[model samples]
Target: MTTNDEARGEHDAPSSRDPQDTDADEYRTTDQHEATSPIDRRDYLRTVGAVGVLGVMGGLAGSATGSAAAQADWETEADRRIAEHRQGSLEVEVVDETGQPVPNADVDVEMAEHDYGFGYVLSANLLLNETEPGHPYRETLKEDFNIVWFGNYHKWRFFEENQEIADQATAWAKDNGLDIRGHVCLWANVDAWAVPGDVVDAMGVDHQSGESGADLDPQHVRDRSFEHVREIIEHYADFEYEGTEYGSVIEEWEVMNEVVHVPGMIRAVNGVPGEQESDDLDPVTAPVLAEWYDHARDVAPEDVGLATNDYNTMEGSLEYARSAYERQIEFLAENGSLDYAGIQSHFGDRDSAVSPEETLDVLDRYAQHGVRLRVTEYDATGDDWSDEEKADFFHDYLKTVFSHDATDAFLVAGGSDAHHWRDDAPFFYEDWTPKPAYHVYQDLVFDEWWTEASGTTDDSGTYATDAFLGVHEVTITVGGESTTEQVSVTDASGTTDLVVTPGTSTSDCEEQGGVQVGEHCARDPDDDSLYEDVNGDGQTTHGDVNALFENLDSDDIQGNADAFDFDGNGRIGFSDVISLLRDI
Candidate 1:
């Protein structure tokens, strides 16, 4: 009955749930609201997400009044004023093709610096139509990229399969010289969930919005979710190929994608002949998501970076930024189990959009709390955007991003198709030629910022490590001569100078004398039993092992001995049996 027994040769028959779907919580996006505030809920709906023109008044009512333009202008002016006081400290200009400084180059510290990289979505749901010269969408970017974010999980099924793709892409980027960034490991949306065999068979094919009155249980969802996260993170990071180094494929990953603070959302529903209602979004999903994220992080390779992503600049809406400021940080602190903060830069076409100044204000609000920020998914979307308009938008958007102090790294979204449903901006025109904006990005964002030496972890541009316990990479801008070198830091040592080897990659940086534990490996035996407590109630009581044993037969222990095997052996044996004995 217990996993220990099952591991100790007393094989228990599989239960109704599939052995693969160990954590069920991930599949069901149920709305779990602890408080009922009709007024507050309505207010959030009106001001959050994409704010309308009139919505600006309500958003900025606390600070100012009048049109959205006024609020944006005011926010911009305030940033300039504050930036002036902190001037020349964070702002670093990019060099042009002629090797001259772009004189009036205003930059954002946050967007330009923090762990910046870009990637293309490789999944079947979102891929460019294949054509001549290899995949048609590959040309959108120039050679020698620093980071490559594999867009979605659908494209990355197996380690070997995706590693081949990553190898090719990395080579292409390396031929041009590029780094690698992994988009996401665990997310509530993107339709990625580990469905058990029982749930599938019970609800036939076409599981979307069809199973009405299917009373889903939370415990089952939690179990399945745990299995999915452990499975995905371990499979990719630990899956070793013959030629490449271990964990070479994906260097960094986005831990949780666009986690929101709203409460109104639905998961599953059945619609009668002329009647249908939206399945409300989950409210209490943050903690479970956080737990899942933490689980993934525990199993992920140490060398890989995990990120929590959300929209950085709220679609030019005052309400967007305001709502984000009020609740975003709070959400993060409570459920912030990530290494990097992923901020989406999807600027929409609005004349009265929040200026770069306002964007920094929002970002700085979060940065004050000591969280590292990254511009995760950046793209522009709005009504009726022309090529010229798009190019101009790109320039302004990039300028605003580069000028901010809150940004750590920026990931510009690139793919073959923009999906007409979302916009008509041809990812590539009929001739497969890049748009003007793409060229601008190449010249302005990529060309100027990227250096031959920058790709190797040792370059001044690359962020070697966040000051976890010892030395880290710190950039010093002296007389406009910016350079990145290592610095020694500790609770006792504080921050002292450490030698940074130039022309080397971040991986090449020396592990300065400090704690060098699991820098690139999944969770070992000692830390694996820790995650069984799905609810995070803190005790390794009966409930924890029960959640783990639900999917024992699924071979879940193959990659994750730490989380699955309570006894810490490679195989789940008598120790696991003894641990789960009480759960039975």
Candidate 2:
């Protein structure tokens, strides 16, 4: 299924090397050194007819990519193509949800790992600034990831316990331009280590009897839960120093988390206390859940997107999971409080791995309700798999997610294995060396799906460009500072136009790896793996050809063979392969 910025890292090699290896540089150059013959497009086309294009393209298809120098030459051509297709200008228009142009506003656009944001669960300690000097992969989040959710860390009680650490985590993410989400504000199991056990237990135990074993009052539990949530959100979301209001750090939040798991203060579902057989709540539980959602929504400012978050809510194949989500969507849709329907997709066992079709179906089903969607917590946990298999899983799974228009973001529940919520994550190992998933992620996010370019609009308030299908951060620069908004540069025919005003200021906007003029930074063309042999067989032969073809029409960084486009055209065609054979 073709999805949206619907595409999809490497790990640390050395900080001293190119930082993008940390995510900085991303341009591919052709392999042609001064000693090698230049690429001749006409000759390549002529030879393709004589030798047959398929044989040329397929013969050494299984081989590795071209030599370093040849790869560089191809990279140069690819970069040229990207530049050539840069029909879209840097100016983008800001609009409210109603589609009206939001003019003259301070707009800031930055790219998230996923259109939403992707990475693992974040611990305050994982932050570089939060850690002591010489922490492992200090810039890993800044380099590779775009968002961090505090699953095991940054909780209400945890914050009260470790405000400094939580503050540091927020500071680091804010500094690096990463988005953030708070896991849970309220849950039935608040007594479980998430918040202060003493506080939650005290909420239930009455001192009137002068004993710890007092019966819990549902209303009392609800009141304390409300107060706790209010304080946390007020502290983080609507921060104030003295009478001056500081901007909020968290823009999105899990207003009611795992409501189906245990109805915290709700006490009963349809008159049943602690209904646990399935995720669906009884009539009693549903209303109470909605009340909590309303309360949380009321506590947060209008800018905040309050989400109804749950695990396995929409695997489709699972009967209870689908039923539970359907109920939640129905209830939230009615309440008009469902800003985001957060789904947790944890694929632990092979059987639990939902197909792309099933995942898309589920997401679409929810989309019909007109609610914003997010994959709040996700992890594909399969054992005894090769590195290639893991990488392949990450690519295909995300492709399915990216293809969907409603997908706001996708976050993995874990990051590094050493500091993971579970056993493993696709991007990291215990040692912090990037896994295969990391490389594939880099190719997709920074390469195939990323468009680093610039253009100017006509007399009309519009700028257009031919962009690959994906979500983009279109930052319109006004004055020296910049304003950014997330926009979609789609694959539809013709040019993708943005409707924002760029200030006349000549100040240049900062970008990650692409060439940058004033107010525009074309995502830097990746040049890192340009000369890499696909199969690592030490030759550019059948294995390489096979790899390139497999990725044909795919925006996958490891798949697209722009370097093989000998004609220096935007695409890889018959002539490109002939040119490769000549080089081989």
Candidate 3:
């Protein structure tokens, strides 16, 4: 199972291990590790076939098939040594498809609570202004920084006017190994002033049925939605956007934006349909939404992520929308149109305080129905809160979200250090140094979450072992702001690395008491000398040589003496020797 010695993409190295590589280091710190348990390196990097750069890597591995037996023999011994090296590391255990613990399995790690799915909104729109190379704001986007929103069509008009912004955002995202969710390919309430002539032209057909002059054809909306989603996803996938210099291609797409709020906004804009000021506010229905999702899926790339969005998920009449969401999930599951669920968390109001337990319950319900939940548009705001409170609140909320078993991913709602908007509060000061709110996210969210493998490349942009095994947490930062995610190693290697993402509190893992840096983020703690209490004094100390000597014949022979004994056990230990001899 040993991986062939092949060239890895320069950007695909383990997080934080190699600071010299700009692309890989962009999302990872110079030192951090994934906290997942170690796995067989041979199996970790063994590539069969893939669809992108990895596909070429697989071909290269295939060329060395003739020497496969020799490599396997080498790997067999190496795997045993590695396993022996890592014995007891902190782990966030997740069940596999077989319902068995894949102990020491390689996993992807993130600072956030969940993976990318329903209930998460990855918002970004600041991408428009920062495209230039020399702009002072350019450096602000360290990595995975982009501004995408639900309603951009109103602002951009089309690709011609917004091309530069879109181009820069796409380029930066691809280069930095970031992913952007295509927000809302179709929104029903078209801003009258922003509506293109094509939309107006299409609306004429429905006018013949006396559906009112302002009423546009829902079918036309469907067609336009599909076309736009298809174009956007394919556009990002194309070499042009990917810097492939050919076409643009994006793997993830939010099919629509805030449909739950659409009704309220539509009513406010034009009154209820058939009423004195009614326009087409009452025209959209559940079935229409299903159609929109279906069309969006049809037009999206095979790997593209699609979702539906809403705000104030915890309470309000909008809480009723959960049923609507349920129906949406059922419809998509039945029709094979749904891939991810979008839950918008606009916490600042009374609704933002939803407990982690409650959120998990909701997510679990959805997961049971075969839906993956992603928290989209998460922001905490309140009129009476102080800067410190806001920060604390933000951290508290993230803690709840990350602790949930059902959530797969979560995304923030603004840009890199964007100004915070609320009824009344001073969240972001003039200099844009983060408010206590900003630091709340910094301590818990940013760090490296990838482990090392056979190739020279790091994990700047590809889904690694954890993700492939369904153990990844996809996090998105909003408000033009970025957050760092400290990754912990979870495998056999005792090394670590750091990975940075957006809008995440560096405290997420800290709250759990861990950090992932380079090669050994997921190493087994039992094997380290630091976790061993050489003196058997209950507390680790330098005065335990005899104690270390006393346990020479005992079974607990692992980890470092002073450094490895994370838990006090007397002995230089067998596990200690194992850890010292460990290698990636």
lDDT of each residue in 1-584, candidate 1, tens digit only? 11121111001223332222221111111122122222221233234422232242243222212355764665465445423321221112233333344333222122112123444333222222232233344433333134556543312222223445434444444332234566554333312222333332222223332233233444544565566566556755543334322233455666544444211111211211111223443322434555666777688766666665554334454454346443544554556455566565555443433455566666676667556666655555455555545554454455555555555456665442232213323234434445555555544433333221111222223222212221223343424544443222222223222222222222332232111111211122235333343212223333333334333444433444555554454565333533443232
Residue-level lDDT of model 3, residues 1-584, one tens digit each, is 00111100001233223212211110211122112222221232243111322232223322211254643554354334323432113223322223333232233333321112212112123333323343222333332233323324222133424555556555554443344566545443332122243543344322221224545344554466456655655565543533234232344566655454444223323323211234433323445556656666665545666766655444222445566666656666677777777676555444335543455567666667676666766665555444454454454455445544445565664422332232121223333333454444433332212222211112222223321111223222334342322232333344222232232232542342322221112122344424333322122222122233234344433322344432234444333322221211
Kindly list the per-residue Cα lDDT of model 2 for residues 1-584, writing each as its tens digit: 11100010111112233211111111111121111222232333344332342233233321122344643554454445333432233345444334455444443433322333555556554443223433433455555566777743455555666666666666656544566787667644432344354444444532221134444445555666678778778777644333322246675777666665545445432323332243454632367667767877888866777777766564425666567667778788788877788887655544455555567678888888888778766655556445555555555566567656677577765545544444466566665565655655666555555555554333333444445444455555444545443444333434544554343222332222222222322231236424323322223443233333344344442234543454355555433433333343
lDDT (CA) for every model shown?
0.39, 0.50, 0.38
What C-alpha root-mean-square deviation, in Å, does candidate 1 show against the real structure? 18.9
Worst 10 residues of 3 by lDDT: 1-10
The lDDT leader among the candidates is 2
Whole-model lDDT for model 3 versus the true structure? 0.38
Error of 3 at 364 (Å): 2.5
Candidate 3's C-alpha runs over 4 A off are 1-140, 143-161, 191-219, 239-243, 246-248, 263-285, 315-318, 350-352, 416-427, 447-584
lDDT of 1: 0.39
Top candidate on TM-score is: 2
For model 1, what is the error of residue 498's alpha carbon versus the real structure, in angstroms, after optimal superposition?
Answer: 15
